[model samples]
Target: QLLDIARKYPDFPIVLETVRECLQDVYDVPALTELMRRVAQRRLRVVEVETATPSPFAASLLFGYVGAFMYEGDSPLAERRAAALALDTVLLSELLGRVELRELLDPAVIASTSAQLQHLTEERAARDAEAVADLLRMLGPLTEAEIAARATTDAIGGWLEGLRAAKRALPVTYAGQTWWAAVEDIGLLRDGVGAPVPVGVPAAFTESVDDPLGDLIGRYARTHGPFTTTEMAARFGLGLRVTADVLGRMAVDGRLVRGEFIDDLPGDQWCDAEVLRILRRRSLAALRAQVEPVSTAAYGRFLSSWQHVGSSDSTGIDGLAAVIGQLAGVLIPASALESLVLGQRVRDYQPSMLDELLASGEVMWSGAGQIGGSDGWVALHLAETAPLTLPAPAEIEFTDTHRAIMETLGHGGAYFFRQLTEQASESELKTALWELIWAGWITGDTFAPVRAMLSGPRRSGAPAHRQRQRPPRLSRYSVARPHSRAADPMVSGRWSALPAAEPDSTVRAHFQAELLLNRHGVLTKGAAAAEGVPGGFATLYKVLSAFEDAGRCQRGYFVESLGGAQFAAASTVDRLRSYLDGVDPQRPEYHAVVLAATDPANPYGAALAWPDRAGDADTHRPGRKAGALVALVDGRLVWFLERGGKTLLSFTSDAETQRAAAAALADLVSAGRLPSLLVERINGVAVLDPGVDAERAAVQEALTGAGFARTPRGLRLR
Candidate 1:
């Protein structure tokens, strides 16, 4: 059977032997001895036994028994040898006792015993099975028994069974009810059995009373290595009072090296090799992570004590110093140190506590007194700590004109010329110079000459023939004369070439009409006729002159009837139109527009009228008569129809139009699709849209829909 079992599992070890006694007998000594010998041989161990009767030769032969007869007799040396050999036998026996022998015995009895054992085990497992069944029933109907079996076989099942047995056997009663009943009522059965109650004193009290002197000694030696009591106490968490006694005992026992108490060691003082190696290998990041959570006050106390023990002489200490110095520099700049001191009633620092640090030159004074000589003033060099640099100027993209100016400046260094000319024409030079000055590229003081040349008074009283003739040139004899002074020719020649002024009654009448129009806003035909103004001549000539001098007007006019400079006019019209387009009246700019519109007879409206007002009287007339002005009443609806397919007014220009427009605007505002009127701007004019109230209503509705509450002014999201 053993061979079959070993063959079945080829990796398993097997042993076999023959015995003189009947194999089936339970207590056959010879057979047992043979079996034990085979067991020892297979396991590679020695076995020994002592004989009652002794013969030297027989004993030697007995000791030579290869399988079942190994033995020793009581001789003085033999007893010692027997004891030595028996130790292995005893150890093997103890090991073999731990292994169960039932599987190796008769199968019928084994099967019967196992069945009985399984019955008991099943009885123990039944409560667990019930719990699993209950849990499965709660979840859903079982899909299969095999799946349910897995839950029953889990550690929780074992725990549940144990708990059930414990509760049944030991029913602990508290407060007039069984503890088990309370546990079930509270659903504590889900987690399994409660811990067993401890007898005698509590473990916490016992552990506290038991001195951990050995552990403390070991930890102290490891952390403070080769240190005396004073140094050890200062460095470690152990209090100084008790540390000296422990250290003295440890020194007497030769566990520590006794030494003279020199608290401050030199920089090169040796420590335990292991400690030095650990310090060398410790990473900065790891140390920072460990120490960062330690409060600054606690760290300061530790550092103060550590300095006293001469631990600050290492490179790690130097690194820490540098870190602290840098931190102080940063924090001092950000924090108001004087204010903190004045505000808080902090404890005064102890002089004795800081004595070691001061004496060892680890601490230094950093206040104004440290500066010395000039009132001991200490000034921080901000530049040394944090430097600032100005941002470089952004490069600007240049146009062709800008590039030309740059090139001209580069060549000319600085120009003194009143005008820059592309060509030598006086008009071109004046135009270019004016453009440059306007664009801020060139500057000059003398604009009078250019201005006069462009628009100036003409000379009068010269005959037509004389005006037409060119000025005379200087004689060669006069130029060749040694000291003959001549009138400044350039000035004389320019003055001579000036054109004579024309004095006509027609011109005078045109000027007079223009002056009147400039002074007053009226241009009545009756007044003109009363002044004997020819029907077409004065008006046509005046209009032409006005057109010529249009560029000189401070407040320029645009003929909206002629669309050349329509932007400014269009903007003004659009601003007024937008305001009338249901703009919020509460907005400052919108209110201004509303006030302007309310006047009805404002002169500014007439000024804004188109020049060809007679042709399209309804469209171009000012005030309510103008089509644009009337459109303002329903402009919101009109704009909506024009801008998008949506209709602001359902009823087209009827009694319902206003109501429909208001409803649509209110809906839009509610939908959050429209901005508040107070903040809206149109055509450089800020106007609140009338839809703002509607928009607020819409926002409130949305917020309420999204599970919020609305107050009078706004909605609260929460």
Candidate 2:
């Protein structure tokens, strides 16, 4: 029967061996036969039900999946071994026959036990106590009269009573007669996983305890996680207060920690200091071991879909807030944020959605850094949780101008743009204001300034409420130089210094690291580093490594060739490996789309470097700039458009890839993902030239194939 089961798992030795050993070694064939007989006789009613998740009763089974969840020390096994001797006559006879066993002794251990024995009873005339103990070990369940007759002692009863008092022996009723057995046989009568018997107690702990009771409890705590007073009391036949008092003393001695160590089992619990450390390490290691590695390309695609970019639109304020929250610390150009970034993630995305959030104090925008033609790229964070990502005051290097603005807001409170610019030029005030925003010290209460910045310089008398047409063609120099003025501020919302989240940098680093894991399904040091987190990736690394130790995050080298440490949420690691699998072959091809260069979904220029550009290295490599864009097919970069939107860089010069890239861009415009894109130039030349470079002509053909219309100077998508 066992052979048949083994055959079913021929390639899995562990499973086969475990099953065989469990039935044969752990439980005898007789036990199995009895269980089967009961089923045949209908004595047992078998109940079975399927569940989508494990039941609470499966807690013990979870230990099989994670061995560290349960700590098994020497005591449980040692007690079981002692019990086996009492249960078998042959083992008892073997011990009696071995005179050599008595010779194997540690004097220090014996002396220690003797010292504790003094506390149980007063000293008396010495008797052959060793001989009496040996007799109990070899042939216990001996009555007082019978023991006295064999050892020739008249006072055997008094001696036996002392031994029982010291817990060196226990009384047993055998054949309706009272007899004494050594405490080593206690395992045969133990309740749960076995408790501390004489064999398992070491000499080291004997000195501190007046008796064996403390040793027993200490051994149990060493081998288990946080347990309740009731649990310990029930196991050892003691009252709750007695158990608590003992544990309290142990805690006072710094031997055990008293607190809620287990999450679900709340209330005061006690655990050994060393045991907790091991528990954390083992739990994390087990979980970390469950996830497999994936390629860098797969990781990139995972982020694209994970963040919901270039996919179906998620509608409503909840969806909008979720997208903004995911991109909490990401900085992109003010122009691309609404027209490109939001449009990619939210359905029918409008400026009003963001304005509503800003107005209600649900969301606020902060300056991330200067990039593209954007005076500076901006990021939106949930207003309530913004303090968590904001830099500490000491981390920010403020100029006199920055300090001045901060001082005013710190004392006077949030001010509107007009009020803030009352004493200084709008441009000058903005320079210091945006600097503070990027430093994470200030936020805007309204999205109007961002709307104005994306709309280009304000028209000569256009009202602040007036909506403009098509936001002027972004300049060739929309490498939009600052013009000796401050970068744009999130002007409309009232401005004030951001409050600090936690004064401790380490705590904030941990939260930020956790956020990164959730933001990107998988996080690498490179991704966190690119965010310019305070103290950089190194600071977050310490927190991530600790999380791995605690089993909150799994650390691994998941993405191929993207070197250095990588950490991912346990579930996402699985999703990344099996991304969008089993889709229909007949459906229209998906997974190709255009993304903002600064979009968090685009790992390039951030988590992973932009694919190498062979000859145009000096033509300004692609970056996470506002006006720049890139096309990806199944998460691999295909084509890149420079910030100026004039020069185009093809990662792969192949026709199919170029066409796929163009088709994705055209669909974006057709689906209103982006309003429109007119390509005026390619690789520093006019988008089209009659009889121009044949190579350039192929790009045009790919674009035309993707529904692009040819114009006098370039291609335009409708």
The candidate that achieves the highest TM-score relative to the unseen native structure: 2
* Residue pairs clashing, model 1: 459-501, 583-690, 584-688, 584-689, 584-690, 669-695, 670-698, 677-688, 677-689
Candidate 1 lDDT over 635-709, as tens digits, reads: 221111111111111112332333333344333335333322121221112123344444333432332443434
The TM-scores of all predictions, comma-separated, are 0.15, 0.52
Model number with the top lDDT: 2
Worst 10 residues of 1 by lDDT: 490-499
lDDT of 2 by residue, 498-559 (tens): 66656777777878887898888778767877777888888888998887756776676667
**What's the lDDT for residue 85 in model 2?**
23
Which residues of candidate 2, in runs, are more than 4 Å off?
A: 1-67, 70-292, 311-313, 369-374, 392-408, 420-441, 461-493, 580-590, 671-675, 683-686, 689-695
- As for model 2, its CA RMSD to the true structure in angstroms is 30.9
Candidate 1 is scored at a TM of 0.15
How many clashes in each structure? 9, 3
